[model samples]
Target: MKQQVRELFPTPLWVLDIPPSDAAPFNAKLRDEIEKIISPRPNVPSGSNWQTPHDLHTRPAFADFTKLVEISARSVAQFLNVERYPMMITGCWANINPPSAYHPTHNHPNNYLSGVYYVAVPEAGPDLIFQDPRPSLIMPWTGKLSPLTANASAEQAVPGRMIIFPSWLRHHVPSNEGTSERISISFNLMFRNFAETAASPRWKATAGQE
Candidate 1:
Protein backbone atom coordinates (compact mmCIF):
# COMPACT_ATOMS: atom_id res chain seq x y z
CA MET A 1 0.00 0.00 0.00
CA LYS A 2 2.98 2.27 0.61
CA GLN A 3 4.15 3.94 -2.57
CA GLN A 4 6.27 6.95 -3.63
CA VAL A 5 7.39 7.35 -0.01
CA ARG A 6 8.35 5.34 3.05
CA GLU A 7 5.60 4.48 5.52
CA LEU A 8 5.61 7.83 7.34
CA PHE A 9 2.56 7.30 9.52
CA PRO A 10 0.64 4.74 11.48
CA THR A 11 -3.14 4.25 11.97
CA PRO A 12 -5.62 3.09 9.36
CA LEU A 13 -6.57 5.38 6.48
CA TRP A 14 -9.04 4.32 3.81
CA VAL A 15 -10.39 5.87 0.62
CA LEU A 16 -13.57 3.99 -0.10
CA ASP A 17 -15.52 4.25 -3.32
CA ILE A 18 -18.96 4.20 -1.81
CA PRO A 19 -21.30 2.65 -4.46
CA PRO A 20 -23.14 6.02 -4.69
CA SER A 21 -25.76 4.53 -7.03
CA ASP A 22 -28.59 6.54 -5.48
CA ALA A 23 -26.24 9.43 -4.78
CA ALA A 24 -27.11 11.72 -7.67
CA PRO A 25 -30.69 12.35 -6.67
CA PHE A 26 -29.75 11.93 -3.06
CA ASN A 27 -27.06 14.55 -3.42
CA ALA A 28 -29.45 16.88 -5.18
CA LYS A 29 -31.98 16.60 -2.41
CA LEU A 30 -29.27 16.91 0.18
CA ARG A 31 -28.07 20.16 -1.37
CA ASP A 32 -31.56 21.57 -1.36
CA GLU A 33 -32.08 20.74 2.26
CA ILE A 34 -28.69 22.12 3.22
CA GLU A 35 -29.34 25.34 1.35
CA LYS A 36 -32.48 25.92 3.36
CA ILE A 37 -30.57 25.63 6.62
CA ILE A 38 -27.67 27.69 5.29
CA SER A 39 -29.67 30.52 3.72
CA PRO A 40 -30.27 31.79 7.22
CA ARG A 41 -26.58 31.70 8.08
CA PRO A 42 -25.13 33.64 5.20
CA ASN A 43 -21.79 34.24 6.91
CA VAL A 44 -21.04 30.59 7.57
CA PRO A 45 -18.35 28.83 5.61
CA SER A 46 -20.07 25.80 4.14
CA GLY A 47 -16.71 24.29 3.35
CA SER A 48 -15.21 24.86 6.78
CA ASN A 49 -18.09 24.98 9.22
CA TRP A 50 -20.16 21.90 10.02
CA GLN A 51 -23.88 22.71 10.05
CA THR A 52 -25.97 19.76 11.12
CA PRO A 53 -28.79 18.94 8.76
CA HIS A 54 -32.33 18.57 10.06
CA ASP A 55 -33.32 15.07 11.06
CA LEU A 56 -29.88 13.88 10.09
CA HIS A 57 -30.07 10.91 12.42
CA THR A 58 -33.64 9.97 11.47
CA ARG A 59 -33.57 10.79 7.77
CA PRO A 60 -33.44 7.81 5.43
CA ALA A 61 -30.52 9.14 3.41
CA PHE A 62 -28.54 9.77 6.54
CA ALA A 63 -29.50 6.38 7.88
CA ASP A 64 -27.93 4.92 4.81
CA PHE A 65 -24.86 7.03 5.52
CA THR A 66 -24.71 5.74 9.06
CA LYS A 67 -24.98 2.18 7.83
CA LEU A 68 -21.94 2.70 5.64
CA VAL A 69 -19.82 3.99 8.53
CA GLU A 70 -21.09 1.26 10.83
CA ILE A 71 -20.26 -1.56 8.45
CA SER A 72 -16.86 -0.07 7.88
CA ALA A 73 -16.18 0.38 11.59
CA ARG A 74 -17.33 -3.11 12.54
CA SER A 75 -15.02 -4.64 9.99
CA VAL A 76 -12.10 -2.51 11.06
CA ALA A 77 -12.75 -2.79 14.79
CA GLN A 78 -12.97 -6.55 14.71
CA PHE A 79 -9.90 -6.68 12.53
CA LEU A 80 -8.14 -4.39 15.02
CA ASN A 81 -9.63 -6.36 17.94
CA VAL A 82 -11.66 -3.52 19.50
CA GLU A 83 -14.00 -4.06 22.40
CA ARG A 84 -17.31 -2.29 21.72
CA TYR A 85 -18.99 -1.12 18.53
CA PRO A 86 -21.41 1.59 19.60
CA MET A 87 -20.43 4.17 17.08
CA MET A 88 -22.24 7.48 17.56
CA ILE A 89 -22.94 10.17 15.03
CA THR A 90 -21.06 13.08 16.60
CA GLY A 91 -22.29 15.35 13.82
CA CYS A 92 -22.50 15.69 10.03
CA TRP A 93 -21.26 18.92 8.46
CA ALA A 94 -21.42 19.78 4.80
CA ASN A 95 -18.79 21.78 2.94
CA ILE A 96 -19.24 23.74 -0.27
CA ASN A 97 -16.17 25.74 -1.22
CA PRO A 98 -16.69 28.57 -3.65
CA PRO A 99 -13.28 29.56 -5.11
CA SER A 100 -10.45 30.00 -2.63
CA ALA A 101 -11.96 28.59 0.54
CA TYR A 102 -10.16 25.65 2.16
CA HIS A 103 -10.09 23.84 5.48
CA PRO A 104 -7.08 24.02 7.78
CA THR A 105 -5.09 21.12 9.19
CA HIS A 106 -6.85 19.89 12.30
CA ASN A 107 -7.95 16.76 14.11
CA HIS A 108 -11.25 16.10 15.80
CA PRO A 109 -10.90 16.70 19.52
CA ASN A 110 -12.41 14.32 22.08
CA ASN A 111 -13.46 11.68 19.58
CA TYR A 112 -12.48 8.21 18.50
CA LEU A 113 -13.02 8.05 14.71
CA SER A 114 -13.61 10.58 11.93
CA GLY A 115 -14.87 10.30 8.36
CA VAL A 116 -15.68 12.32 5.27
CA TYR A 117 -18.03 11.58 2.39
CA TYR A 118 -17.25 13.49 -0.76
CA VAL A 119 -20.22 14.58 -2.82
CA ALA A 120 -18.41 16.74 -5.31
CA VAL A 121 -14.74 17.43 -5.96
CA PRO A 122 -14.03 20.01 -8.58
CA GLU A 123 -10.75 20.11 -10.40
CA ALA A 124 -7.75 22.25 -9.34
CA GLY A 125 -8.34 22.64 -5.60
CA PRO A 126 -8.43 21.22 -2.10
CA ASP A 127 -6.20 18.22 -1.64
CA LEU A 128 -6.48 16.33 1.67
CA ILE A 129 -2.92 16.23 2.99
CA PHE A 130 -1.79 13.44 5.31
CA GLN A 131 1.38 14.40 7.19
CA ASP A 132 3.86 12.43 9.21
CA PRO A 133 2.70 12.70 12.83
CA ARG A 134 6.07 11.86 14.34
CA PRO A 135 8.52 14.15 12.60
CA SER A 136 10.69 14.50 15.70
CA LEU A 137 10.96 10.75 16.36
CA ILE A 138 13.71 10.31 13.81
CA MET A 139 17.00 8.45 14.09
CA PRO A 140 19.77 10.95 14.94
CA TRP A 141 22.24 9.33 12.54
CA THR A 142 21.49 9.94 8.91
CA GLY A 143 21.65 6.82 6.78
CA LYS A 144 20.14 6.96 3.30
CA LEU A 145 17.63 9.83 3.29
CA SER A 146 17.60 13.28 4.86
CA PRO A 147 14.62 13.55 7.20
CA LEU A 148 11.90 15.84 5.97
CA THR A 149 9.73 17.94 8.21
CA ALA A 150 6.17 16.78 8.89
CA ASN A 151 5.09 16.95 5.29
CA ALA A 152 1.99 16.28 3.27
CA SER A 153 2.38 13.03 1.35
CA ALA A 154 -0.82 12.95 -0.75
CA GLU A 155 -4.05 14.73 -1.57
CA GLN A 156 -7.39 13.04 -2.22
CA ALA A 157 -10.76 14.55 -3.14
CA VAL A 158 -12.88 12.44 -5.46
CA PRO A 159 -16.66 12.26 -5.72
CA GLY A 160 -18.51 9.30 -4.25
CA ARG A 161 -15.48 8.44 -2.19
CA MET A 162 -15.38 8.15 1.60
CA ILE A 163 -12.28 8.61 3.73
CA ILE A 164 -12.30 7.12 7.22
CA PHE A 165 -9.48 7.14 9.70
CA PRO A 166 -8.65 7.49 13.37
CA SER A 167 -9.88 10.88 14.62
CA TRP A 168 -6.53 11.85 16.10
CA LEU A 169 -4.70 11.74 12.76
CA ARG A 170 -3.76 15.31 11.79
CA HIS A 171 -4.95 16.07 8.24
CA HIS A 172 -5.55 19.18 6.18
CA VAL A 173 -6.79 20.38 2.83
CA PRO A 174 -4.69 22.71 0.76
CA SER A 175 -6.33 26.02 -0.13
CA ASN A 176 -8.64 25.68 -3.08
CA GLU A 177 -6.69 26.78 -6.08
CA GLY A 178 -9.45 25.92 -8.52
CA THR A 179 -12.35 27.99 -9.79
CA SER A 180 -15.21 25.66 -8.89
CA GLU A 181 -16.70 24.69 -5.58
CA ARG A 182 -15.89 21.59 -3.50
CA ILE A 183 -18.54 19.70 -1.56
CA SER A 184 -18.16 17.14 1.23
CA ILE A 185 -19.34 16.20 4.72
CA SER A 186 -17.23 15.40 7.78
CA PHE A 187 -18.21 13.32 10.82
CA ASN A 188 -16.95 12.17 14.23
CA LEU A 189 -17.66 8.92 16.04
CA MET A 190 -17.14 7.08 19.33
CA PHE A 191 -18.09 3.71 20.84
CA ARG A 192 -21.25 3.79 22.98
CA ASN A 193 -22.19 0.30 24.21
CA PHE A 194 -19.39 -1.12 26.29
CA ALA A 195 -20.89 -2.25 29.62
CA GLU A 196 -23.23 -4.67 27.90
CA THR A 197 -20.42 -6.35 26.00
CA ALA A 198 -18.31 -6.91 29.14
CA ALA A 199 -15.13 -7.38 27.11
CA SER A 200 -13.70 -3.96 27.97
CA PRO A 201 -14.84 -1.01 30.04
CA ARG A 202 -15.22 2.55 28.85
CA TRP A 203 -13.04 5.27 30.35
CA LYS A 204 -14.65 7.00 33.32
CA ALA A 205 -13.71 10.43 34.64
CA THR A 206 -13.28 11.07 38.33
CA ALA A 207 -14.36 14.70 38.96
CA GLY A 208 -12.38 15.70 35.83
CA GLN A 209 -11.09 14.33 32.52
CA GLU A 210 -7.50 14.79 33.71
Candidate 2:
Protein backbone atom coordinates (compact mmCIF):
# COMPACT_ATOMS: atom_id res chain seq x y z
CA MET A 1 0.00 0.00 0.00
CA LYS A 2 1.13 3.54 -0.77
CA GLN A 3 0.74 6.56 1.50
CA GLN A 4 -1.05 9.67 0.31
CA VAL A 5 -1.63 13.18 1.66
CA ARG A 6 -3.41 16.38 0.68
CA GLU A 7 -4.52 19.72 2.12
CA LEU A 8 -8.04 20.85 3.06
CA PHE A 9 -9.04 17.78 5.02
CA PRO A 10 -12.01 17.89 7.41
CA THR A 11 -12.62 16.20 10.73
CA PRO A 12 -15.97 16.27 12.46
CA LEU A 13 -16.63 15.46 16.11
CA TRP A 14 -20.17 14.61 17.12
CA VAL A 15 -21.72 14.31 20.59
CA LEU A 16 -25.11 12.73 21.10
CA ASP A 17 -27.27 12.16 24.14
CA ILE A 18 -28.95 8.82 24.50
CA PRO A 19 -32.69 9.16 24.63
CA PRO A 20 -33.74 7.86 28.02
CA SER A 21 -36.84 6.16 26.70
CA ASP A 22 -34.72 4.16 24.28
CA ALA A 23 -31.56 3.75 26.33
CA ALA A 24 -33.31 2.72 29.56
CA PRO A 25 -34.88 -0.39 28.14
CA PHE A 26 -31.67 -1.38 26.47
CA ASN A 27 -29.70 -0.87 29.64
CA ALA A 28 -32.09 -3.06 31.55
CA LYS A 29 -31.85 -5.72 28.91
CA LEU A 30 -28.08 -5.56 28.92
CA ARG A 31 -27.89 -5.85 32.69
CA ASP A 32 -30.02 -8.96 32.55
CA GLU A 33 -27.82 -10.48 29.88
CA ILE A 34 -24.69 -9.72 31.84
CA GLU A 35 -25.95 -11.71 34.78
CA LYS A 36 -26.90 -14.61 32.56
CA ILE A 37 -23.42 -14.92 31.05
CA ILE A 38 -22.23 -16.80 34.15
CA SER A 39 -18.82 -15.27 33.82
CA PRO A 40 -16.73 -13.93 36.69
CA ARG A 41 -14.99 -10.67 35.90
CA PRO A 42 -12.96 -9.90 39.02
CA ASN A 43 -10.84 -12.97 38.44
CA VAL A 44 -9.35 -11.22 35.42
CA PRO A 45 -5.76 -10.36 36.24
CA SER A 46 -5.08 -6.69 36.71
CA GLY A 47 -3.81 -4.93 33.59
CA SER A 48 -4.60 -7.94 31.45
CA ASN A 49 -6.49 -7.78 28.17
CA TRP A 50 -10.01 -9.18 28.48
CA GLN A 51 -13.20 -8.32 26.56
CA THR A 52 -16.86 -9.20 26.91
CA PRO A 53 -18.59 -10.34 23.75
CA HIS A 54 -21.88 -9.88 25.58
CA ASP A 55 -21.56 -6.15 25.08
CA LEU A 56 -21.72 -6.63 21.33
CA HIS A 57 -25.02 -6.55 19.51
CA THR A 58 -25.05 -10.35 19.49
CA ARG A 59 -28.16 -10.26 21.63
CA PRO A 60 -31.61 -9.79 20.09
CA ALA A 61 -32.07 -6.45 21.82
CA PHE A 62 -28.97 -5.15 20.10
CA ALA A 63 -30.98 -4.67 16.91
CA ASP A 64 -32.54 -1.66 18.57
CA PHE A 65 -29.17 -0.30 19.58
CA THR A 66 -27.73 -0.85 16.11
CA LYS A 67 -30.75 0.77 14.57
CA LEU A 68 -30.29 3.73 16.84
CA VAL A 69 -26.68 4.10 15.77
CA GLU A 70 -27.55 3.67 12.10
CA ILE A 71 -30.13 6.37 12.29
CA SER A 72 -27.76 8.72 14.07
CA ALA A 73 -24.86 7.90 11.75
CA ARG A 74 -26.92 8.54 8.63
CA SER A 75 -28.01 11.84 10.08
CA VAL A 76 -24.39 12.72 10.80
CA ALA A 77 -23.39 11.70 7.31
CA GLN A 78 -26.10 13.92 5.89
CA PHE A 79 -25.04 16.86 8.05
CA LEU A 80 -21.44 16.34 6.96
CA ASN A 81 -22.74 15.82 3.43
CA VAL A 82 -20.99 12.46 3.13
CA GLU A 83 -22.33 9.62 1.03
CA ARG A 84 -25.52 8.64 2.85
CA TYR A 85 -24.94 5.36 4.63
CA PRO A 86 -21.70 4.90 2.72
CA MET A 87 -20.48 3.37 5.97
CA MET A 88 -21.44 0.05 7.46
CA ILE A 89 -21.06 -1.25 11.01
CA THR A 90 -18.56 -4.06 10.81
CA GLY A 91 -18.07 -4.79 14.52
CA CYS A 92 -19.09 -3.47 17.91
CA TRP A 93 -18.41 -4.46 21.52
CA ALA A 94 -18.38 -3.14 25.05
CA ASN A 95 -15.37 -3.17 27.41
CA ILE A 96 -15.07 -3.62 31.16
CA ASN A 97 -13.40 -1.75 34.03
CA PRO A 98 -10.01 -2.01 32.43
CA PRO A 99 -7.09 -1.96 34.88
CA SER A 100 -4.52 0.79 35.02
CA ALA A 101 -3.15 1.52 31.56
CA TYR A 102 -6.29 -0.24 30.31
CA HIS A 103 -6.04 1.11 26.79
CA PRO A 104 -3.04 2.07 24.77
CA THR A 105 -2.96 4.89 22.23
CA HIS A 106 -3.98 3.50 18.86
CA ASN A 107 -5.99 4.14 15.74
CA HIS A 108 -8.86 2.20 14.30
CA PRO A 109 -7.70 -0.54 11.96
CA ASN A 110 -8.98 -1.12 8.42
CA ASN A 111 -12.18 0.88 8.77
CA TYR A 112 -13.55 4.05 7.23
CA LEU A 113 -15.29 5.53 10.27
CA SER A 114 -15.26 4.74 13.99
CA GLY A 115 -17.10 5.92 17.10
CA VAL A 116 -17.67 5.41 20.81
CA TYR A 117 -20.88 5.84 22.75
CA TYR A 118 -20.54 6.38 26.45
CA VAL A 119 -22.77 4.23 28.57
CA ALA A 120 -21.07 4.72 31.91
CA VAL A 121 -18.09 7.01 32.36
CA PRO A 122 -16.38 7.03 35.72
CA GLU A 123 -15.63 10.30 37.43
CA ALA A 124 -11.93 9.66 36.97
CA GLY A 125 -9.54 7.71 34.83
CA PRO A 126 -9.93 6.74 31.11
CA ASP A 127 -10.87 10.11 29.74
CA LEU A 128 -11.00 9.99 25.94
CA ILE A 129 -7.80 11.41 24.47
CA PHE A 130 -7.90 12.59 20.88
CA GLN A 131 -4.50 13.09 19.28
CA ASP A 132 -3.33 15.16 16.35
CA PRO A 133 -4.08 13.09 13.28
CA ARG A 134 -1.37 14.69 11.17
CA PRO A 135 2.03 13.01 11.38
CA SER A 136 4.29 15.97 10.67
CA LEU A 137 4.90 18.41 13.56
CA ILE A 138 6.26 21.32 11.61
CA MET A 139 4.10 24.34 12.30
CA PRO A 140 3.79 27.98 11.07
CA TRP A 141 2.86 26.65 7.62
CA THR A 142 -0.52 28.27 8.21
CA GLY A 143 1.30 31.34 9.58
CA LYS A 144 0.18 30.39 13.10
CA LEU A 145 1.84 28.47 15.91
CA SER A 146 0.17 26.29 18.54
CA PRO A 147 1.26 25.95 22.12
CA LEU A 148 1.86 22.80 24.17
CA THR A 149 -1.79 21.71 24.43
CA ALA A 150 -1.90 21.76 20.64
CA ASN A 151 -0.80 18.17 20.33
CA ALA A 152 -3.92 16.63 21.96
CA SER A 153 -6.93 17.13 24.17
CA ALA A 154 -8.80 15.01 26.68
CA GLU A 155 -12.41 14.76 25.56
CA GLN A 156 -15.08 14.99 28.24
CA ALA A 157 -17.49 12.13 27.75
CA VAL A 158 -21.04 12.23 29.10
CA PRO A 159 -23.89 9.83 28.89
CA GLY A 160 -25.62 9.80 25.51
CA ARG A 161 -22.55 11.46 24.06
CA MET A 162 -21.18 9.81 20.92
CA ILE A 163 -17.96 10.76 19.15
CA ILE A 164 -17.28 9.94 15.50
CA PHE A 165 -14.29 10.54 13.27
CA PRO A 166 -12.30 9.10 10.42
CA SER A 167 -11.24 5.56 11.30
CA TRP A 168 -7.57 6.38 10.93
CA LEU A 169 -7.59 9.05 13.62
CA ARG A 170 -5.53 8.07 16.68
CA HIS A 171 -7.22 8.11 20.12
CA HIS A 172 -7.24 6.23 23.42
CA VAL A 173 -8.63 6.09 26.94
CA PRO A 174 -6.45 6.26 30.04
CA SER A 175 -7.03 3.91 32.96
CA ASN A 176 -10.25 4.26 34.95
CA GLU A 177 -10.12 6.24 38.20
CA GLY A 178 -13.37 6.33 40.18
CA THR A 179 -14.79 3.50 42.24
CA SER A 180 -17.46 2.94 39.62
CA GLU A 181 -16.47 1.16 36.43
CA ARG A 182 -16.29 2.82 33.06
CA ILE A 183 -18.04 1.28 30.09
CA SER A 184 -18.54 2.31 26.50
CA ILE A 185 -19.55 0.63 23.27
CA SER A 186 -17.32 1.08 20.23
CA PHE A 187 -18.15 0.63 16.56
CA ASN A 188 -16.39 0.49 13.19
CA LEU A 189 -17.75 1.88 9.95
CA MET A 190 -16.60 0.86 6.47
CA PHE A 191 -17.58 2.01 3.04
CA ARG A 192 -17.43 0.38 -0.36
CA ASN A 193 -13.75 -0.12 -1.13
CA PHE A 194 -12.85 3.41 -2.14
CA ALA A 195 -9.60 2.30 -3.75
CA GLU A 196 -11.34 2.65 -7.11
CA THR A 197 -12.00 6.33 -6.34
CA ALA A 198 -9.43 7.51 -3.84
CA ALA A 199 -6.14 8.64 -5.34
CA SER A 200 -4.36 10.05 -2.27
CA PRO A 201 -3.76 9.40 1.43
CA ARG A 202 -6.15 12.19 2.28
CA TRP A 203 -9.73 11.13 2.90
CA LYS A 204 -11.93 11.94 -0.05
CA ALA A 205 -13.96 15.01 0.85
CA THR A 206 -17.54 13.93 1.42
CA ALA A 207 -20.58 14.91 3.45
CA GLY A 208 -20.23 14.97 7.29
CA GLN A 209 -16.48 15.02 6.92
CA GLU A 210 -16.34 18.42 8.51
Candidate 3:
Protein backbone atom coordinates (compact mmCIF):
# COMPACT_ATOMS: atom_id res chain seq x y z
CA MET A 1 0.00 0.00 0.00
CA LYS A 2 1.10 3.58 -0.78
CA GLN A 3 0.59 6.48 1.57
CA GLN A 4 -1.51 9.35 0.18
CA VAL A 5 -1.98 12.96 1.28
CA ARG A 6 -4.00 15.88 0.04
CA GLU A 7 -4.38 19.52 0.92
CA LEU A 8 -7.55 21.48 0.29
CA PHE A 9 -8.81 25.05 0.37
CA PRO A 10 -5.46 26.80 0.35
CA THR A 11 -5.46 30.61 0.48
CA PRO A 12 -3.35 32.69 -1.84
CA LEU A 13 -1.01 35.47 -0.78
CA TRP A 14 1.27 37.13 -3.30
CA VAL A 15 4.30 39.24 -2.47
CA LEU A 16 6.22 41.36 -4.99
CA ASP A 17 9.59 42.78 -4.16
CA ILE A 18 10.62 46.09 -5.73
CA PRO A 19 14.38 46.59 -5.88
CA PRO A 20 15.69 48.90 -3.20
CA SER A 21 17.34 51.15 -5.75
CA ASP A 22 14.02 51.89 -7.38
CA ALA A 23 11.94 51.80 -4.21
CA ALA A 24 13.91 54.31 -2.19
CA PRO A 25 13.52 57.20 -4.61
CA PHE A 26 9.99 56.37 -5.61
CA ASN A 27 8.83 56.24 -2.02
CA ALA A 28 10.36 59.63 -1.22
CA LYS A 29 8.75 61.25 -4.26
CA LEU A 30 5.38 59.69 -3.53
CA ARG A 31 5.43 60.78 0.09
CA ASP A 32 6.12 64.36 -0.92
CA GLU A 33 3.36 64.31 -3.53
CA ILE A 34 0.84 62.86 -1.09
CA GLU A 35 1.58 65.54 1.49
CA LYS A 36 1.13 68.34 -1.03
CA ILE A 37 -2.45 67.63 -2.06
CA ILE A 38 -4.19 65.30 0.37
CA SER A 39 -5.27 66.23 3.88
CA PRO A 40 -5.56 63.65 6.65
CA ARG A 41 -9.08 62.58 7.55
CA PRO A 42 -10.15 61.65 11.07
CA ASN A 43 -12.12 58.66 12.31
CA VAL A 44 -10.78 56.28 9.71
CA PRO A 45 -12.37 52.84 10.02
CA SER A 46 -9.09 51.04 9.31
CA GLY A 47 -7.33 52.49 12.37
CA SER A 48 -4.34 54.52 11.31
CA ASN A 49 -2.55 57.47 12.85
CA TRP A 50 -3.74 59.31 9.77
CA GLN A 51 -5.51 58.22 6.59
CA THR A 52 -6.04 60.01 3.32
CA PRO A 53 -9.44 60.26 1.72
CA HIS A 54 -10.26 57.16 -0.32
CA ASP A 55 -9.75 58.90 -3.66
CA LEU A 56 -6.04 58.72 -4.22
CA HIS A 57 -6.49 56.75 -7.44
CA THR A 58 -8.21 59.73 -9.05
CA ARG A 59 -5.40 62.16 -8.43
CA PRO A 60 -3.06 63.08 -11.29
CA ALA A 61 0.01 62.76 -9.11
CA PHE A 62 -0.72 59.10 -8.44
CA ALA A 63 -1.12 58.18 -12.09
CA ASP A 64 2.17 56.32 -12.37
CA PHE A 65 1.81 54.56 -9.06
CA THR A 66 -1.72 53.54 -9.98
CA LYS A 67 -0.48 51.92 -13.14
CA LEU A 68 2.07 49.91 -11.19
CA VAL A 69 -0.58 48.75 -8.75
CA GLU A 70 -2.91 47.73 -11.56
CA ILE A 71 -0.16 45.64 -13.13
CA SER A 72 0.46 43.84 -9.86
CA ALA A 73 -3.26 43.23 -9.38
CA ARG A 74 -3.57 41.80 -12.86
CA SER A 75 -0.78 39.37 -12.08
CA VAL A 76 -2.70 38.16 -9.06
CA ALA A 77 -5.85 37.64 -11.11
CA GLN A 78 -3.91 35.77 -13.74
CA PHE A 79 -2.28 33.51 -11.16
CA LEU A 80 -5.73 32.60 -9.89
CA ASN A 81 -6.74 31.61 -13.46
CA VAL A 82 -9.43 34.28 -13.64
CA GLU A 83 -9.80 35.09 -17.32
CA ARG A 84 -13.44 35.88 -17.54
CA TYR A 85 -13.30 39.67 -17.21
CA PRO A 86 -10.81 42.45 -16.85
CA MET A 87 -9.82 43.63 -13.39
CA MET A 88 -9.56 47.31 -12.50
CA ILE A 89 -8.77 49.46 -9.56
CA THR A 90 -11.86 50.66 -7.73
CA GLY A 91 -10.18 52.79 -5.05
CA CYS A 92 -6.83 53.63 -3.47
CA TRP A 93 -5.74 55.32 -0.25
CA ALA A 94 -2.78 55.91 2.01
CA ASN A 95 -2.17 55.20 5.69
CA ILE A 96 0.42 56.69 7.97
CA ASN A 97 0.82 54.70 11.16
CA PRO A 98 2.77 56.47 13.83
CA PRO A 99 4.06 54.83 16.96
CA SER A 100 1.39 52.84 18.80
CA ALA A 101 -1.07 53.18 15.90
CA TYR A 102 -2.57 49.91 14.74
CA HIS A 103 -5.30 48.56 12.53
CA PRO A 104 -7.95 46.19 13.88
CA THR A 105 -8.82 42.95 12.09
CA HIS A 106 -11.06 43.60 9.12
CA ASN A 107 -11.58 42.67 5.50
CA HIS A 108 -12.34 44.68 2.37
CA PRO A 109 -15.95 44.56 1.29
CA ASN A 110 -17.51 44.62 -2.20
CA ASN A 111 -14.22 43.95 -3.96
CA TYR A 112 -12.66 40.86 -5.46
CA LEU A 113 -9.06 41.72 -4.53
CA SER A 114 -7.13 44.02 -2.23
CA GLY A 115 -3.49 44.91 -1.65
CA VAL A 116 -0.97 47.18 0.04
CA TYR A 117 2.35 48.63 -1.06
CA TYR A 118 4.89 49.75 1.45
CA VAL A 119 6.16 53.26 0.80
CA ALA A 120 8.14 53.65 4.00
CA VAL A 121 8.69 51.15 6.78
CA PRO A 122 10.95 51.66 9.72
CA GLU A 123 13.31 48.92 10.88
CA ALA A 124 11.01 47.90 13.73
CA GLY A 125 7.66 48.37 12.01
CA PRO A 126 4.84 46.06 12.95
CA ASP A 127 3.91 42.97 10.99
CA LEU A 128 0.81 42.31 8.86
CA ILE A 129 -1.16 39.53 10.55
CA PHE A 130 -3.78 37.37 8.85
CA GLN A 131 -6.42 35.16 10.44
CA ASP A 132 -7.82 31.98 9.03
CA PRO A 133 -11.14 32.62 7.32
CA ARG A 134 -12.67 29.23 8.14
CA PRO A 135 -13.77 29.22 11.75
CA SER A 136 -15.64 25.91 11.74
CA LEU A 137 -12.50 23.92 11.08
CA ILE A 138 -11.23 24.76 14.55
CA MET A 139 -14.26 23.35 16.39
CA PRO A 140 -12.47 20.06 17.01
CA TRP A 141 -9.38 21.59 18.51
CA THR A 142 -8.16 19.69 21.51
CA GLY A 143 -4.88 21.44 22.24
CA LYS A 144 -2.39 23.90 20.73
CA LEU A 145 -0.65 22.25 17.82
CA SER A 146 2.13 22.97 15.32
CA PRO A 147 2.14 24.43 11.79
CA LEU A 148 -0.35 21.84 10.58
CA THR A 149 -3.05 23.39 12.73
CA ALA A 150 -1.92 27.00 12.98
CA ASN A 151 -4.76 29.46 12.39
CA ALA A 152 -2.92 32.75 12.02
CA SER A 153 0.23 34.02 10.35
CA ALA A 154 2.23 37.24 10.19
CA GLU A 155 4.37 38.86 7.50
CA GLN A 156 6.91 41.56 8.12
CA ALA A 157 6.68 44.76 6.13
CA VAL A 158 9.55 45.71 3.85
CA PRO A 159 10.02 48.98 2.01
CA GLY A 160 8.81 48.80 -1.61
CA ARG A 161 7.22 45.40 -1.08
CA MET A 162 3.74 44.76 -2.44
CA ILE A 163 1.32 42.15 -1.08
CA ILE A 164 -1.92 41.06 -2.69
CA PHE A 165 -4.62 38.79 -1.29
CA PRO A 166 -8.29 38.02 -1.60
CA SER A 167 -10.53 40.79 -0.33
CA TRP A 168 -12.44 38.43 1.93
CA LEU A 169 -9.44 37.48 4.04
CA ARG A 170 -9.36 39.07 7.49
CA HIS A 171 -6.08 40.74 8.42
CA HIS A 172 -4.73 43.53 10.60
CA VAL A 173 -1.59 45.38 11.54
CA PRO A 174 -0.04 45.50 14.99
CA SER A 175 1.04 48.72 16.75
CA ASN A 176 4.01 50.47 15.22
CA GLU A 177 6.70 50.63 17.82
CA GLY A 178 9.30 52.34 15.70
CA THR A 179 9.98 56.03 16.07
CA SER A 180 9.37 56.87 12.41
CA GLU A 181 6.05 56.53 10.66
CA ARG A 182 5.10 53.40 8.71
CA ILE A 183 3.60 54.56 5.43
CA SER A 184 1.68 52.35 3.03
CA ILE A 185 -0.68 52.71 0.09
CA SER A 186 -3.70 50.38 -0.03
CA PHE A 187 -6.01 49.68 -2.97
CA ASN A 188 -8.92 47.48 -4.06
CA LEU A 189 -9.69 45.89 -7.41
CA MET A 190 -12.85 44.57 -9.00
CA PHE A 191 -13.97 43.00 -12.25
CA ARG A 192 -15.33 45.30 -14.95
CA ASN A 193 -18.60 44.56 -16.67
CA PHE A 194 -19.24 45.11 -20.34
CA ALA A 195 -22.82 46.12 -19.64
CA GLU A 196 -21.64 48.93 -17.39
CA THR A 197 -19.41 50.27 -20.15
CA ALA A 198 -22.12 49.99 -22.81
CA ALA A 199 -24.63 51.87 -20.67
CA SER A 200 -22.27 54.77 -19.98
CA PRO A 201 -22.99 56.60 -23.25
CA ARG A 202 -26.75 56.34 -22.82
CA TRP A 203 -26.52 57.46 -19.22
CA LYS A 204 -24.41 60.45 -20.21
CA ALA A 205 -26.94 61.51 -22.87
CA THR A 206 -29.81 61.16 -20.43
CA ALA A 207 -28.04 63.23 -17.83
CA GLY A 208 -27.29 65.93 -20.38
CA GLN A 209 -30.90 66.05 -21.53
CA GLU A 210 -32.09 66.33 -17.94
TM-score of each: 0.71, 0.73, 0.82
* C-alpha lDDT of all candidate models, in order: 0.68, 0.69, 0.83
Residue 30 displacement (Å), model 1: 2.9
Q: List, in order, the clash count of every candidate structure.
A: 0, 8, 0
Better of 1 and 3 by lDDT: 3
Which candidate leads the pack in TM-score?
A: 3
Model 3 reaches what TM-score against the true structure?
Answer: 0.82
lDDT of 1 by residue, 1-210 (tens): 866866554566877775568667666666676676567655755444344562355566567666776777677667667745566666767776666676777898877778887767778746687766664565454454332633345647777777888888898877667767677777777777645664465777788557
Tens digit per residue, CA lDDT, model 2, 1-210: 999876466566777777777766666665455445525665767764445663465566568778877877787778878664376687877766654536778888988778887766666756788888767675544454343326676778665667877788788777776667676778887766456545346657888776
- Residue 57 of candidate 3: its Cα lDDT? 89
lDDT comparing candidate 3 with the true structure = 0.83
After the best TM-score superposition of candidate 2, give how far the Cα of residue 163 lies from its true spot, in angstroms. 1.3
Kindly list the per-residue Cα lDDT of model 3 for residues 38-57, writing each as its tens digit: 55534544335777878888
Q: Poorest 10 consecutive residues of model 2 by lDDT? A: 140-149
